[model samples]
Target: MAEARSFLQRNRIHRALSRSNLLLGGDRELVLLTALAAAILIFVVLTVYSALLGISIWIGILGALRWMAKADPLMRQVYTRHINYRHHYAPTSSPWRRP
Candidate 1:
């Protein structure tokens, strides 16, 4: 009789690695960058109008990012990889053939 095996079952680490890492309902790095930029603008400018503008910009960016994330969590990575490929690639029959 063949022995049963659960050895290939997914574990906690696998789940963690597979999940999308989101921040403020959006991509982590992009949200952080937007926060940093907004903070800099708000503080460095030191004006009521500038502060309002900064907050507005930050809110707009966050809203847009959140909307995008809701649409697709892995869109950023997908788009980055997508841009590297051509619209169509011809098949190569042999290793020696020039691509």
Candidate 2:
């Protein structure tokens, strides 16, 4: 059973690596969008059953925004602009700062 499990894990990793290579070799924008979508999907799915419905809903909303950004250039531009501005304006303090 352990051997079989290891084999399955290896196969999954191989397939994921191959798919990642294909995505990386193609259009960079598509790869970024795909990665964002996958991350949001995983977050929602993982949190759906936990006592974190609010967090899951927030992630789902962001995922919807990401999807819309993919369809609308203006949305993408606004989203990135705000993100850059936030990072620029925020102070870079110590890593272990308490609230």
Per-candidate alpha-carbon RMSD to the true structure: 5.5, 18.5
Residue-wise C-alpha lDDT for candidate 1, range 36-90, written one tens digit per residue: 9999999999999989999999999999999999999999888987777756555
**TM-score, model 1 to reference:** 0.68
Candidate lDDT values, in order: 0.89, 0.54
Residue 16 CA displacement from its true place in model 1, Å: 4.1
Question: Worst 10-residue stretch by lDDT in candidate 2?
Answer: 19-28
* Regions of model 1 farther than 4 Å from truth: 1-17, 86-99
Q: Count backbone clashes in candidate 1.
A: 0
Clash count in backbone of candidate 2: 0
